[model samples]
Target: MVDRLGPRYASTLGWLFATMVSMLFVYRPPLSLLMLFLWKVVGLLPRAVPPVVIARKYRDARASVLSAFNAALTLISLAGPTIIGIVASTDPALPSILRATTLLIPIVII
Candidate 1:
């Protein structure tokens, strides 16, 4: 699949599948077989594709490019949370928005 579609595309699809599964959480479904089904399905997605695709994509990349990519990722990761934290810390309603995003982290860890 990676060879045919390319690592970038395959990785995108992997993350997309994970995101689609995660969207189910917004419904606040009751604890039942369905909730278990969603959790188990979401867990499978990143394990299935992301690590291999990401590792393969970067393994052969030049050191300079990888360094730049890492720096960019670090900047974005830090900046987003810092900005959101600042907003949520000051605003009452913003915390819910930040809390909503908490659902995304588990799948991302996978």
Candidate 2:
């Protein structure tokens, strides 16, 4: 969905999400389960690259692109537990803001 939206709009959405999330820390607003789930959904959005977009983007080298993508996903899967463990170890009481920040890292990079 985000890839289909293209880079500009995708960036807009990311900024909007960041702004809303930062407000939680700034204002200390009451958090809801739905909002937390939405944050996760947003964080996961960048990982969902549509096949059509991938096909179009790498028309000349689809196989190579796909292989690289697959490798990256594998690396991420392998590293995720390590990354989470390190982050979680830093503070036993990992706050929601920190959790959300960790989740949003990929989206921000995208």
Candidate 3:
């Protein structure tokens, strides 16, 4: 299945699998730290890739709009964790919700 998708998508799927499996072992401190690092690296990927990809794939006015959109998304992505952390900390009931949402982050990104 992976071979059919080519390298980028295949590696993405592999990373997702590794991250999900890592979460199962997260009760162990060292394993949890490793998983956290993996998740962090994966989380940064979209910010690193999208603007350049868009710029390369388009030109002139369309490229400008795509670049702007990509920039906004990157900024939002960077801010998302901080915002979620603040909300989780300030509201007692929100931590569980945030945790549930964040579970997908590790799997999808890492």
lDDT (10s digit) by residue, model 3, range 21-92: 544333222223544454454445455568766455434444455456556555545444444333333433
TM-score list, all predictions: 0.28, 0.25, 0.26
lDDT of 2 by residue, 27-106 (tens): 34333465445444444434479867655554535445445655655554544444443343344244555556655654
Model 1 over residues 5-107: C-alpha lDDT tens digits?
A: 8755665455445445544443332344644454444445455577777555444443444456556555444444344333333433333544345434543
RMSD of every candidate to native, in Å, equals: 21.7, 20.4, 19.8
Query: All models: lDDT?
Result: 0.47, 0.49, 0.47
Q: In candidate 3, what residue range of length 10 has the lowest lDDT sum?
A: 23-32
User: Of the candidates numbered 1 and 2, which has the greater lDDT value?
Assistant: 2
Clashing pairs in 3: none
Q: Lowest summed-lDDT stretch of 10 residues in model 2?
A: 22-31
lDDT of 2: 0.49
Q: Rank the candidates by lDDT, best first.
A: 2, 1, 3
